[model samples]
Target chain A: MKNVQRIWTQGVALFGLSIIVGIAYNTTRIVSVPWIAQPIQLVNEMDRILKPVYEPSIKNISIDIAKQLVDKNIPFIDARDDEYYHEGHIPHAHSSGDLIKLTEYLDIAVGLFNPFVVYCSDDDCGSSEELAYQLQSEGFMNIYVFKGGWKEWNASGLPIEITSNE
Target chain B: MNKYIQLGIRLIVGGLFIYASIDKIVDPSEFAKQINNYHIIPFGLENAIALILPWLELFTGIGLIMGIYLEGSTIWIFLLLISFIALMGQAILRGYNIECGCGLKEGQMIGLAKIFENVIMLIALYWVIIQPKKYFIIFPKTELEE
Candidate 1:
């Protein structure tokens, strides 16, 4: 019983010591992380500087809006992995799995000013929002995140294309 | 022979911990994303975990190697190993093919292999706990004398 108590005390002491050192050291770092995670804000503050008119660059769209965008022939970006993307995705959607490859294709095929939609596996998946944020950072002005992504699209009986491995 | 073997295990485990903490401490944002991939920790607490965990690993590793707080360090490492095993096991079972977030190796995906590796380390930690002889300890002279 005494040994258990002693061990617990010592373990806690070490933990407390670590917290002190960790927070102190993080303060000294040039790129220190916030102690608490800030919520994901789709609005990029840089937009104010880049576009004085200041509309949100990234917008969360419903399946209806996403469908409308598809009908209009706007480009779509799949934020899921290559395997998942290859399995089945919205027709004409580009894969954002490899940012470099995606950006390269975007450079030649699409303009930064044109609107694009990003989506992932499902509503619960965060990759769509994450990709939207990445696009926003990359100075893509008009971005839409289809929160109800592939799952919703497929469930709705929307048009999809499966890429062959050949 | 037994004494030298135990000392060697101590140093190896300690060294491993120190090595693991470095990359995590450097790129905490990436580490936070890795932790979030597990889908276990909620309320954005992965950020705090990412911040503190590497430091704990570093201190635990240093304590083990220096023999500064042998019992505490071993206990901490044991607890950490168990949590890691549990987290990895759940991630594998759920079919979330994500990065391991181990900080030891980059881009190492979570799988049975990682669990096996951790299990081996857990066994080593257990060995250190049961061993009667402790050598070259710099602090808490009483334990060193024993």
Candidate 2:
């Protein structure tokens, strides 16, 4: 019957459309940049929205920080887990990850108002910078992140203080 | 029965598909992750599924809205609905916690409620398809008295 033929044609058409739509949508994403993942940025201006939040800046410190630390006896904190800190960490550094508890450890290690530097696993890890931000939020005026973190320190053969808090 | 209602439903459903596809087309990575999380498709097919499906939605949607190919577009919409339902049902049965990816963005959980909603909509569409007499479209059956 004519109706049966029409049904068959419609079914075939629908099947074809499904395939076409599926392919087109996927291709659009493959060509897009990573910025697409951050949808919130689209709704608000990045700088204005992010400025008040704790962030790291270039002037946080330079290489001479080591001499400064030795001279002023500045405190160093490791942001990785206890295992990484035990395996190796900056000499005289303590391990801390939760930003809320940085001050407790700081109090035990170097007392309030002492300059502090925090470092984490690697460049890809944002934990160090995040911890630094939390410190700033808590009114710890002189906080910095050793951006190179543990990987950079170990890779460059820097002197490490070994501890066995195991 | 009036003929306008059937045409109106088709246009509304088709337009919805086109509008929905736009956001996904703009960002496929988010949608791709959603598709993978459903666990209905293998990881390898995620990219392919993400690539071109939106265009099909847009095209079919527009075609239906325009009333240029009502019969063809209705069929396409039905098939799409069935596949979506199947995919959702399978995912639920398998106990996958995932965003359906039917709507915009990733990490938005779509559960059995959405699947059920689609089923009802598909049924309505099927009713319209079978008996278009209650609706109106640009094209109507007529004769010159041949």
Candidate 3:
């Protein structure tokens, strides 16, 4: 038991020393990049590991609001892959999830005045949130994520586009 | 067994840890994301763990290899391995099919295989912990001669 306690105490001391050294080592990097110039600044949850700054929060929208937006004829963006997009998508929603496709669709996206309601395959799918953050970084304001995405919409028997891939 | 066998285990374990900390120390953001996938910590302390854990591994690995701090370091090694076994076990039970985030960058999914890998490492570390004679250490004459 004494040896065990000694080991534990030593481990704690070693860990604390490592943290101090690690922070100093990482901070005194060869090149110091400005936080604002970074593609995305770390904030909130990312602050724990990331330095310089924490990531800004992204706005999330619920399915009900997403449905209302759909009814209002606001442009919808599908944040899923080409295969998934072609499988089935929300009616009238444009596919701009992948980088290549989004670049191709950028002309239309930049010209649009209404906010983009982006969604992925399902609730657990992070693509929608990720795409929203990407758009925000690109100076596109008022992006909303349909947290309950294609899965919820399809299950609810709402408007959907089934493009046969097979 | 041979004292050389213990030396071999020490080197292997220490080298493995040093090898493991490299990728994590480089890309902690991605590592934090991987930890969050485990769905264990609620407060998003994964980042804190990510920032600090690799350095701990580095020092412990070095200590093991050099045999400067044999008992405490090996104890830490075993403790870390046990925790890894538990983490992998929990991930398997919870059905997390995400990348194992093992040293090789998503080497495999967390499953029985990953758990078994850590188990084997734990066995090796335990051997280091209780070895009657550590062969290659330079400091702490009392620990070495005893």
**TM-score of chain A considered alone, across all candidate predictions:** 0.67, 0.56, 0.63
TM-score of chain B of 1: 0.95
Using lDDT as the yardstick, the better of models 2 and 3 is 3
lDDT at residue B70 of model 3 (Cα atoms): 63
Error at B98, model 2, angstroms: 1.4
Q: Model 2: per-residue lDDT, tens digit, A3-115?
A: 55765775566557766655543446445433222211111222232222234321234334543463455677787767778999877787784555768777666454445
Listed in order, each prediction's TM-score against the native is 0.81, 0.49, 0.64
Model 3 chain B, TM? 0.91
Error of 3 at B58 (Å): 0.7
The CAPRI classification for model 3 reads as acceptable
Q: What is the C-alpha lDDT of each candidate?
A: 0.79, 0.61, 0.68
| lDDT, model 2, position B66 | 67
Q: Model 2 chain B — which ten-residue stretch has the worst lDDT? A: B137-146
iRMSD, per candidate, in listed order = 2.4, 9.7, 5.8
lDDT of 1: 0.79
Could you tell me which 10 consecutive residues in candidate 3 chain B have the lowest summed lDDT?
B137-146
> What does DockQ give for each predicted structure?
0.55, 0.13, 0.29
Cα lDDT tens digits for candidate 2, B12-92: 788778887887777665556566555445435665566556666776687677654556667777888999899888866
In the range B15-45, model 3's lDDT, one tens digit per residue, is 9888888998887765665665565655557
